[model samples]
Target: MDLPPLVEPAATLTDAELRRYARHLTVPEIGCTGQLRLKNARMLCVGAGGLGSPALLYLAAAGVGTLGIADDDVVDSSNLQRQVIHGEAALGTPKTRSAAARIADLNPLVRVVEHRERLTAATAQEVLAGYDLVLDGTDNFGTRYLVSDACELAGVPHVWGSILRFDGQYSVFWGAHGPTYRDLYPVPPAPGTVPNCAEAGVLGVLPGLLGTAMAVEAVKLITGVGTTMLGRVATYDALSARWWEISLVPTPGRPAVTELGVGQDEDPGCAVPCPSSAEDAPTVTAPQLAELLAARERGQTDFELLDVREPYEARLAAIPGARLVPLAQLESGEALAGLDPHRRTVLHCKVGARSERALRLLRAHGHADVAHLEGGILAWIAQVNPAQRPY
Candidate 1:
């Protein structure tokens, strides 16, 4: 269904804007009035990577009046393959700054706001409150849920997109008008069940394709030009060159989001328990784990090194002596029989979130000697083995 335009038309477009957006003004669906609406729209893009890269550039080119970019990460050489907004000169530069510079170069008329900070549960509402619309291109489940909940609470529409390997999915979630992200994914998939783009790898051009689609939806929403993706999800498979749409309905009996940060208990995406305060579960820093491993190798002490990440992740990089027992197998009790109760066990995952969950699960099942590696393999790469490439 077509909704009213998200923003009212501005008084008029400048001569340069009229010429710059001549193609847009030529269209009956998005003529001078719609171009003015685009000029009046304020959009907040959650990440300046991958999907956000293409989406931000296109939105700026489309003449969005104000674009807010929220991202705390810096550009690395690894990001160049997909995050086209940043270049070789941007290496070690903050993603927000890189994206802002690119956007300014693309269209000086569009104002770019840089939010070089991570969006946390505490900051989500405040950060999201000022925008008319949000584009969520965050990679993790926890951030995705946070973005969705914050948008729902703020009554802002969220245009979301995800790309993995060769597949992509994009949708719009507006709690006031239709289904939300939770309506589509009530519970997050089990940790480690889904490999992120970093872990699984993504085609270089995949984000460009999907992120461009997200930009289209945002333009449609702003101008009320065509049917928006409010109640539907579109999936694209690059391998097969196929496109499919699925109708989404609000889940019956789903609790309404009345406040921010109220659903953590029910959200499986909140994988990491507060480390300092979590009872019974202890954490080992990367250095401590290294020392322990050295001691075990020297026969001075003994403990089990359990890697709770997926098989493919282990293949990417792994600790020397850690046994690969993917989190799913441990959660299902299939890997429990192999664990020996006599030895102390240390768990690790990509970072620390999934391993923390594994620690809690082990304790729940009466294994009292398990502790998780504080920062997981990434920490090890950072502190112990600088040669190991981290995902």
Candidate 2:
């Protein structure tokens, strides 16, 4: 399809902007005109965590005029590795506030607006309306769809990104130029089916790589120079140090521009966890787990409680009837096929980390009834069955 005419370029940057962005203005692809556009552009990044960290830093450094942050999470010790925007002093502080303080320090010229509340359906459109573009750095499905739908309604292009372990995905969605996120993932998957970074684990540098790519996309979109990944989705494999691109086309019969509205039916890809897969895995929680164990003891529920923890940890204490299937061995492939997807399955590790990782992998592989013991067996021991031993 033929592309639409590009917007007129913004006027040249000021002397101060030139010096602040000398490195960027020096680049032929992004000269004074681009710097001016960057200075005038307003961007809202949904999450101030991993993906938001680098994305916000680059946008601020590039002189995005107004930056809006929407996040309710506090900066935790665990987030330091990937969320570069937050520092030791900011730990325990709200993520949005922490990020805003950092942005203020990075460039006083860039105005920073902070939304210390979580982004939800009711407030999404209101918060996103004034922005020129939105960068979705959220880790959960609910917020991803919320941001995508709001962007589609506001007609603001969204730079989307996600990372897991060694892999990352980035895409540009919605504009007078191309398709929205609904075109890709029209629905959200079952809750908890998709494990988060805390559960699945991500390489410390992975989000930085993806977030920088998002920053680059935002710059290109705002400047109208070089290639914009409007309809193309880029995938990165950090372990292999390789990148792949796939083109996305608008779904036939999907609404054009005006008919678009925020509705559950609009996002089909939302039905499944992002990084869509052919696999079908189910996830369970701690309460449900204790109930399951109780039912099994009473011969009411018949299923498998596969202990995906290591052998050394298992020696510490194991749940009755829980079979050990150390996570490392499951990576080998054969050990994984031993379980029955059609039956109820519960996975657990020491503190629920590896079990959650196994849950995502199992979901990717087509198992639908798998769940990790909430807080793992540790919680099981603390709450449900006090008689049960935990390590």
**CA lDDT of each prediction against the hidden true structure:** 0.88, 0.78
lDDT digits (tens) for residues 69-154 of candidate 1: 99999998889999999999998899999999999999999999999998877788888877999999989887888888888989
- What's the distance in Å from true for residue 144, model 2? 1.8
- Work out the TM-score per prediction: 0.82, 0.72
Q: Which candidate has the top score in TM-score? A: 1
Model 2, position 155: C-alpha lDDT score: 79
In angstroms, give how far residue 31 of model 2 lies from its true place.
Answer: 3.7
Compute the lDDT for candidate 2: 0.78
In terms of lDDT, which candidate is strongest?
A: 1
